[model samples]
Target: MTLDPKEPVLRVVPGPTDINANGHIFGGWVLSQMDIAAGIVASRRANGSVATVAIDTMEFLAPIHLRDVISVYAQVERVGRTSMGIRIEVVASRDRGREEVKVTSGLFTFVAIDADAKPRPVDAPE
Candidate 1:
């Protein structure tokens, strides 16, 4: 569930504070990062305010320890009139030591919103 460089998206690295007491990255922390990444893709495609609607089939494959430098990549996989589906992958590596391993991944659905906070049609990218 990792993303190749060909995908149009951005990468994010989490910091030490992102980890939890269990010494592994918290599931909530990971989901937040994915949401942020997905929001970037969603906003660009929607061209307006966007909110997370749903997350599907999220699976945590490996434990992400403190300072593991997790990377998140996201892309718009599908677009509807009012909503867009984004695919996000969370990967972690030990600074070129261990190869990048996918720690978790999921699909997030977002709905475009207007200034009034009402669902609106997502504009296709130019």
Candidate 2:
């Protein structure tokens, strides 16, 4: 799938410290970004706090360089009683946004939580 041009949930540029021995951005760094973006979407949909339950699927389509600006797009793809499936896509903008490349994609599951930190119905009134 192509990267959506709409507003991204998060955008960041990796630094030299985030690079790995391969001279590319660390995979874990991108994963963490994805998780953070997905959490934002999940929490918005749930109208409260949410916790990541699982990473259902993840794919690395391309490498990210330090000069690349990463844009993360996340949305709630599915909703259950107390859980939500978030779809996240990461695009790397290089050459000052002249080129956009799909670097990673992931599907994450999150559960809505109450003040007690226990799972709660996602549709419950806020």
Candidate 3:
């Protein structure tokens, strides 16, 4: 997938401890980052608490290196009565931002919740 040029919701660099035996950043680390980014967009759209209900699709396009700067971009793709779909994309900037690669992409579903932790209408005002 093409990396979007828009500003990312989050950016982070992985440390040595995040690397796997294969010398690449662990998949779980990037997955968590995607979840965090998606949650931010989901919560904003829901205007309150939100929880991840499903990951519709996830693709690991390339390996992430330790020195790479990871940027996570997320947007609300669809909205229902009580759930929304978030599209998340991750890019890695290597060699001090000279090289950018699309590392991961995912579609996550989140349910809007109320104080009681029950699903609520996504369009409900806060």
Give the CA lDDT, 0 to 100, for residue 15 in model 1: 70
Worst lDDT 10-window in candidate 1: 1-10
lDDT of each: 0.79, 0.92, 0.92
Cα lDDT, model 1, residue 61:
90
In the range 1-126, model 2's lDDT, one tens digit per residue, is: 323437799999999999999999999999999999998888888888999999999999999999999999987789999999999999999999899999999999999999999999998854
- The per-candidate count of clashes, in order, stands at 0, 0, 0
User: Each prediction's TM-score against the native?
Assistant: 0.83, 0.94, 0.94
Note the residue pairs that clash in candidate 3.
none
Off by over 4 Å in 1: 1-13, 95-97, 124-126
User: Measured by C-alpha RMSD in angstroms, how accurate is candidate 2?
Assistant: 3.5
TM-score sort, best first: 3, 2, 1
Query: Clashes in model 1: which pairs?
Result: none
